[model samples]
Every structure is written in structure tokens, then in C-alpha cells.
Target: EPEVTQTPSHQVTQMGQEVILRCVPISNHLYFYWYRQILGQKVEFLVSFYNNEISEKSEIFDDQFSVERPDGSNFTLKIRSTKLEDSAMYFCASSVGTPKQYFGPGTRLTVT
Candidate 1:
């Protein structure tokens, strides 16, 4: 089976800077999601997209964050400003209309 893939496996940025994380989900999957796990915390949902629009988003996905499907095969997450608290491992996932989701190796974001 195909899998989700993320770029820049590790990212480091200064506080208040902007960053964009990229992901390429399974080609045939129609549902896409972004999740994050702080250093040792549980995986938390950030947002879900389907049919070219945001289907659901969590409070953690505040105004500073955005998701986009810039083309047929790529999905992205943009953080307008980085905060120390935002440092975490961000993961991209996809599913075929089910509860099971395939996850990508996360991109670790470190804010200083």
C-alpha cells in the first residue's frame, strides 16, 4: 500500500517566524489530515480536509495555521508565526472514507 510522505524531516526556526510543512498523501485517498505530537505528548488532531475544503479543525489550529492543497498531489500546512510551544512533530495522514488513517513520518519543528 502507498503511504504519506513529509518533507524536511526536521525544521528549526526562530520564534515569531513563519514556516510551512509539506506532505504528499496517498494518491488515491480522498481525505487528508494533519496531526502533531509534542515531545512526549499524545498525537493531537490539527485539521482535516476533503473535497478541497477544510472539513474539521481543532482549537490548536488557530488563525495562525492554514492548510492547502496547492495541486493535485500535494498538501501543506503553514504556520504564520512560530512559538516555542508550537515545537512538535507534525504528521500528515490520509484515509479512504474510514476511521483508519495512514500516517507519514513526522516533521519535527523546533522553535527557539
Candidate 2:
């Protein structure tokens, strides 16, 4: 089975800096999403993209954040200016509907 891949399993950065997390979503999948877990918090949806546009987005996906399908299989999340509150595990997910999401191990962002 194919798997979603993320880079820099761990990242440490000072607050207010820019960070771009990369993901290679599953091939042949149509829906993509970004979710986060703030330490002990539940996985919360940030955004979902389909057909080249945002299908839905949660309040957590604010102006400071952006996502793109830079290429066929590459999806990227960029935080223009990170905050201390942004420290969390960012997971990239994909599904062909039915909401059967497959998540990457995640890129743990640490801000200070």
C-alpha cells in the first residue's frame, strides 16, 4: 500500500518565523486535508482541498497559513508567521471520500 510522506519529522524554530511543511499525498486520491493536534488536544481540521480549491476550512486555518498543490503529488502548508501557539503536530491526510483519512506520521512543530 502507498503511504503519505512528510519531511523533517521534527522542527524547532523561534516564534514569528516562517515554516513550510511538505507532504506527498497518496497517488490517485482526490481529497486532501490538513489537521493539527496541539499536544494533548484532539485532531482538529484546518482545511480541506478538492478540485484545486478549498472545499472547507476550519477557524484554525487563519490568514497566516496557506496550502498549495505545488505539483501532482506534492502538497505544502506554509505558515507565514508562526506563533508560540502554533506548536503542534501537523498532519497531512488524503481520502477518496467516505472520510477514511490516512494520516502522515506528522511534522512536530516546536516554537519558542
Candidate 3:
């Protein structure tokens, strides 16, 4: 079966550095999204991408953030500058026009 997968299951960085989180979603899925969970906080949507352009984005996705599809199979999220509060679990998900989403295990980002 197809599933979303992410790299560097865990990452630790300094507060002012940059970080790039990578993910590969199910091949047939058309919609891709990035979301984050700050330690004890609820899951928050960051952005959604489709057809090589951003389809939707939350306020949390500020100028410091960006998303790109480097190839047909890989999707990436980059944070221009990290903050202590950026520590959290980031999830990548995909869906084929369904309410249901297939999610990756997630990449844990920790900033000192």
C-alpha cells in the first residue's frame, strides 16, 4: 500500500538556523499539506500545495516559510529562520479529493 514518508525522523538546531523538512507522499495523491504540533498544542495547518502552486495557507505560514515540489515525487518545507518555539512535530499529508488524509509518521524539529 502507498503511504507518506519523511526523512530525518528527528532534528535539532540552533534558534537562528534554517531547517528543511522533506516528505514523499503517496504517488496517486494530488493534494499535499504541511501541519505542525507544538509540544502540547493542537495540530496546526501550515500550508497546502497543488499543481506546483500554493493552494491554501494558514497564518502560521509566514514569510519565514516556504514549500516546494522539487520533483514529481518529493515535497519539501523550509523555515528561513528557526525560533525556540519552532520545536514541534511536523506532519506531511496527502489526499485524493477525499475528506480522509494519509499522513506521514512526522519529523520532530527541535530548536535550542
Candidate 4:
């Protein structure tokens, strides 16, 4: 079975530093998305990408954030600056034009 893969599984950073989270989605999936769940908070959508373009984004995806498909096989999320509130578990998901999305194990970010 195909599955999404994420790297570094865990990250620890300073409040003002930058961080890049990486993921590789299922090979045949068409839509990709990024979401985050702050500790004790609900999972929130951050952005969705398809056809090498952004399809949708939430207010949480501010100027400080960006996503890229640097290689056909890999997707990345970059945060220009980190904050204490940025500590959370970031998930990467993909779907083949369906509401059922397959999610990665998630990368937990811890900012000090």
C-alpha cells in the first residue's frame, strides 16, 4: 500500500529561527495539503496544493509560511520565523480527488 512519508519526525528550534518540514506523498495522489494541531487544540488546515499551485489556504498560512514541490516526489513547508505558539504537530496529506485523505505520521515541532 502507498503511504505519505515525513522526515525528521521531530524538530526543536529557537523562537526566531526558520524551519522546513518535508513530506513525500503517495505517488499517484493528486491533491496535497498541510495541517497543524497545536497542543490541546484541534487540527487546522493550513494550505492545499495541486497541479503545482496553491488551491486553498487558511488564515493561519501567513506571509511567514510557504510550500514547495522542489522535486516531483517531495513536498516541503517552510516557516520563515518560528514562535512559541508554532509548536505543534504538522501533518501532510494527499487524496485522489476524494474527501478521504491519507495522512503522514506527522512532524512534531517544538519551539523554545
Candidate 5:
């Protein structure tokens, strides 16, 4: 079975450093998305990229965030200037569209 893979299941970073979270989406999928869940919050969509451009995005994706498909098999999310509020579990998902999406185990980002 195909699955989305995210690296560094746990990340601890300072208050003002850049961090690049990496993910490998399922092969043959047409849509990829980045979502986050704050400790007691619901899963929120950050951004969705397909055909090399953003398809949909949520208010949470601010200027501090950027996403890229650096190569054939890698998808990355970069956060500039981390903040304490940024601590959350970031999930990477890939799907053909709106039916079902496969999510990565998640990278728990902890900022101090």
C-alpha cells in the first residue's frame, strides 16, 4: 500500500529559527496538502498544492509559511521565524481530490 511519509516525528526548536519539515507523498497522487492540529484543536488545512500551484489555502498559511515540491518524490514545508504558538502536529496528506486522503503519521513540532 502507498502512504505519505514525514520525517522527524518529533522536532524541538527555539523561538526564532527556521525549520523545514519534510514529507514524501504517495506516488501517483494528484493533490498534496499540509495541515496542522494544535494540541486541543481540530485539524486545519494550511495549504494544498497541485499542478505546481496552490489550489486551496486556509487563513493559517501566512507569510511565514512556504511549501515546495523540490523534486520528484519530496514535498517540504518551511516555516520562517518559529514562534511558541507554532507548536503543533503537522500532517501531510495526498489525495486525488475530495473523497479520501492519506495522511502521514505527523511531525510533532514543539517550539520553545
Candidate 6:
């Protein structure tokens, strides 16, 4: 089965810098999501996108965060400014209008 893939499995950045986390979701999936797990915490939803537009977003997805489907196969999350508190493992998920979601290995972001 095809699975989601993310780039730079581990990323280390300085505080106040910009970072873009990339993902290629399953080809047939119609919905894509960005989630984050802050080390010991549970996975938290940040944003969801469909048809090249945002469908929903959590409060955590502030003005600093943005999502885009730059091309047919690529979906991305951009953090305009990284903060120490934003350090976490960011996951990309996709589903075909179902509760079950396929998640990528995740990009571990470390902000100093």
C-alpha cells in the first residue's frame, strides 16, 4: 500500500526563523491534515485542506501558520516564525472521507 512521505525526517531551526514541512499524501486521498505532537502530548490537529483550500483549522493554527497544496501531489505546512514552544513532531495525514487516517513518519522540529 502506498503511504504518506515527509521530508527532512528531523529538522533543527533557530527561534524566530521560518520553516516549511513537506508531505506527499496518498494519491487517491481527498483530505489532508497537519497535526503536531509536542513530545509527551497527544496529537493535536492544526489544519485540514481539501480541493486546494482550507476546510478547517484549529485555534493553534494562527496567522503564523499556513497550508498549501502547491501542486497536485504535494501538500505543505509553513510556519512563518518558529518558536521554542513550537518544537514538536509534525505529522501529515490523509483520508478518503473516513475516520481512519494514514499518517506519515513525521518531521521532528527542534527550535532553539
Between 1 and 2, whose TM-score is larger?
Answer: 1
Candidate 4 C-alpha lDDT tens digits along 1-108: 989999879999999999999999999998999999999999999999999999999999999999999988999999999999899999999999999999999999
- Model 5: per-residue lDDT, tens digit, 1-112? 9889999899999999999999999998889999999999999999999988888888889999999998988999999999999999999999877669999999999999
lDDT of each: 0.97, 0.92, 0.95, 0.97, 0.94, 0.97
In the range 1-112, model 1's lDDT, one tens digit per residue, is 6889999899999999999999999999999999999998999999999999999999999999999999999999999999999999999999988999999999999999
- TM-score of candidate 3 relative to the true fold: 0.97
Candidate 1: segments with Cα more than 4 A from true spot: none
Q: What are the clashing pairs of model 1?
A: none
RMSD versus native structure for model 1: 0.6
Tell me the spans in candidate 2 whose CA falls farther than 4 Å from its real position.
none
Per residue, candidate 6 scores C-alpha lDDT tens digits across 20-52 of 999999999999999999999999999999888
TM-scores, all candidates, are 0.98, 0.96, 0.97, 0.98, 0.96, 0.98
What CA root-mean-square deviation does each model show from the true structure?
0.6, 0.8, 0.6, 0.6, 0.8, 0.6
lDDT per residue (tens digit) for residues 24-45 in model 3: 9999998999999998899999
Q: lDDT score, residue 58, model 2?
A: 96
Worst 10 residues of 4 by lDDT: 1-10
Cα displacement (Å) at residue 78, model 1: 0.3
